[model samples]
Target chain A: MKFVGVTSCPTGIAHTYMAAESLEQAAKDAGHEMIVETQGSAGSDPIPQSVIDAADAVVFAHDLPVKDAARFAGKPTIDVGVKRAISDGPGLIAQAAAAAADFKANPAKAAAAAAAAPTGGLATKVDSSASLGTQVRQWLMTGVSYMIPFVAAGGILIALGFMLATFALGKDGPVLITAYDINLPKDVAHSIMDSFNPLSLTWWAALLFRVGVAAFGFLVPALSGFIAYAIADRPGLVPGFVGGAIASTTGAGFLGGLVTGILAGLVARWISRWKVAKGVRGIMPVVVTPLLSTLIVGGLFIVVLGRPIKALMDALTNGLNGLGGGSLVILGLILGAMMGFDLGGPVNKVAYTFATTGLATVGLATDAVQYKIMAAVMAAGMVAPLALALATQLRPKLFTEPEQENGKAAWLLGASFISEGAIPFAASDPARIIPASLVGSSITGALCMAFGATSPAPHGGIWVSLLFGNIFGFLIALIVGVVVMAAIVIALKSRDHSLAAANA
Target chain B: MSLISESQVILDLDYPDRHQATRALAETLVADGRCTDLDLFLSDVRKREEQMATGLPGGIGIPHARSGGITTPSLVFGRSRNGIDWGAEDGPATLIFLIAAPDGGGDAHLAILAKLARKLMRKDFRQSLSDAATAAEVVEIVEREVVNA
Candidate 1:
């Protein structure tokens, strides 16, 4: 007998590969030849089509729906949880082998056997008991993942645009204070030297700046559209995008984007649950759901929600600007806690977008308040991974071999300002790791703000310290944060090990 | 050459500890022409053990390396009837698979190790190995599951 298997999990880290190992062992023990594929966070090594075609049966041990499931349409298969593949691998292989034999003996039995296999075979059942907070977080993460490319591409282009614009100015010119200030002075711009030459360095720089601004314009709608798609699939998209456009038009910013996205998603979801006839249901997804949801969400945003949200947004901007030293530190602390709370998750995205939006509108190079927020956000973001790398080095015995290897990479990732480097540790032991990250990051954010540090650039972590108004203060904040985070994480891990030993 | 041979199989070996077990396996690999130098292989294995404990669930220890001392890819299977400490949090290992490969073997070594590691995940495979009546039956099981199958 021959079989093929795929193992996948939600986080796509440890569980996926662990299950693959188990499945391979079980097939060999059952005296059946097999090839196993792992679909993990690092991506997949897809099995060859020839192997799939030759296989008698297939096994799918997954938490999320397997990608490209249609490839195994007619095959006799078994699907189970990833955990089952790890603990009961032999038994699962035996079951698959038996099914394979039955199909060979009688091909007609394939469909019936597949139907009788289990409930989670193709479309898995949802756990109704899962908390609301957990569900919201998952949906928010889906939106944020889709929104990141826009941020990276747009923000980097805008930074490059400004850098080039500054270079075009003669040494006698004063530093370009703002993006808008990049337009050549009236006399030069009207001169025949500038008019006859459309591809001047200043013109090219302005073009780059405008294109980057256009891409940034899509950020809110993308976030809103995807958030709704996560909730109600295709039907939610139009309403979510329209609602988000209204939010941006009304000056509600990122906070308004969040409200409209969740509202649009819930509304679309509620509409999807309606008990319509089969004929109507077919057309509902195509026409009815989108039209009605868009009308409702768009109308609500424009009429009822727009002014109130705008007022709230205005109050928020004023509050941030008016904050005294103590209150500014507190605000920084809050933003920092949010950034590390989930490590590149929805919470982190919220803090990031908050800072980036401020950079976009508040004249980052000139506005001290705006640049200080950016400094605090980047410093807090860098702390999680840097602290984790430090913790692994301080107590290597506390971590697994893979984690220690990850630590070596985290050093560069953290320095370059990538918080996602710490995600593996957080995913492994969320209860302990998250709290430690939060406590340390909050302290870092508070200290950075208190030091009155500022940054012109939106990204680049510790390497961008030269851009900071107070480089010494920025370094002090980062070092203090790294030390605190490392200390907390090490302490937590030690306690966990002792408790495990005691239990044993 | 094949990764494993009948001569390298150690059925019901009585090793007092993990160090002795590792040393006994290294000697067999050298004798079978699978390893170039006994001392180098032993040191490489010891260095790997220090990096991480190889003891897995199901009473198995897979001490593996891709070292300069290896002449060819090889697997040395040892059945320790009394069990020896493999640094597993669960308990000692009754089955030890000493995996070695040439330093330049690259993905080939990982491919073979992955194949063997997957099979060791099965309780039935471990149970059959433990209850094998003779060294020949043990070799048959390893050949079918770890090498050919």
Candidate 2:
């Protein structure tokens, strides 16, 4: 017997190919001939006309809308979920063949009803409950990808700024001062310094510099929204950007941006369900929704969110500045603990947000705060993924080949302050891995703070931060944190057979 | 071996679900005396599908089954005017390739699959096949491609 089949899913990632492989294997085993076509990201690549003409039966496994069902005007098709297609495709194909014969024998009733129904429209609604965890993981991945470049660009620039200022004060050769003058300004010459200062210099240049920084700042949210949009489709971007901007301007920082990005993506999806014309549909995305949403959200930030948050950020920065002797150690411990507690979850985000806010409002604005908490938070976050990767590499038996591949990427990502690098591990074994990550990250954070490491950059991982100042202490803190986390992971993973078994 | 048996092939003008596709394919087989019991063939294929999915990364689906209902391996191709959800990465599938190999064929079946996988990877070859309107043309293209490879 000869049969033809089609398999597809909404996102078109994993299940599509698995079903095709299964059905082909089954057909070969059962002493039959079969050909399968996958409708996925790459697009259709099969003999459509010939397949329709020669096939005795057809099977369709899909979740999203498919095209061209009308060509098989008289052919029987078995429509099932993509998951079902992968899990039970051959059976569906066989069922389709039998139903086709029965219809041919008694053509009138079945043909009439089937003809009346629209093609590719019959699909079971997706169960959101089953997909929530996957959605969260995807959201985190998008956020991490977006955050990396921001940390790199902002961190390196700020470091350069600091080094240049230090050189101008005669701490180093005038090489950095010359570079800063070319890239930005020179502060050594009183004439040059006076010419550029906000009060003494032309206000235009200062305004341009501030605007440039503000525009550069906008990139963090914009890119975050764009990545989330790509993952979740058109609707996800609007809210992602709005949320990111709100997070940024309100001192909620990157953590807030991550939350907003996810919120925006999910909200856009819900809104897309409101049926509208295809012509107007394009407008719903490119124009109306984004414009209105950004305004409403931005307004909310200014009117309600920003003012109250301003006081808290001020008080925190002030309190940190006031700490002395043993109290500084306690502060470091608290900040470090908060940084690692969530590892990019809500608590991690709060600490990160506070740090960025402190950079802008306290560090750059005034010398009111001597210690930088944001740097510690970022440093800690970076340590968790690197530590996890190292742990996985050390114990090859603890992870699958795929996970090991992810570990390499995680190490690179973590070194660059890409907090999302730990996602795959967290996803695979949340119970054991997350706690271990938190411990490692917290230790790094606290140690870095206690050792008096200060990062002028609002964001960065170890490498860029190390270039600024206090390289020795930063390296020590990072290595210690990584070792602490690795030990914890090794201990926890060894105790749990399920983790090893699952990965293996 | 011929890519497809001419007598066992049927051009379908109706679009039913998987049940209908199966029935149409089986009826064609039964008419050619390939199998005595269509229900047994249907059940076997359905049961086989319970293990894994047949959806490919590209926008294609290959649904097939193994059963005593067939005397020899056969290939069936179908096209949907309005495509159906076939669990493909891009979404729905418009073209279908069904393969039914004799039980315990082993290496022979694997050889055919290897050839098919290689041929399908070629964009122009797959495009030409999708454009082919007749079963003989599809068989001709497949045979030519396979022989050339």
Candidate 1 reaches a DockQ of: 0.08
What lDDT score goes with residue A222 in model 2?
61
Candidate 1: tens digits of C-alpha lDDT, residues B49-89: 78656676667787766578988778888988778888877
lDDT over C-alpha atoms for residue A120 of model 1: 36
Instruction: Report the C-alpha lDDT of model 2 over A326-432, residue by residue, as the tens digit.
Output: 67656556666776666676566656656654554422421223425656766787877788789878997887665777787788889878776776677667788
Name the best candidate (by lDDT).
1
For all candidates, state DockQ relative to the true structure. Answer: 0.08, 0.02
Off by over 4 Å in 1: A1-24, A27-60, A63-129, A167-201, A272-283, A362-365, A429-432, A462-468, A488-504, B1-149
Q: What clash pairs does model 1 have? A: A25-B118, A25-B119
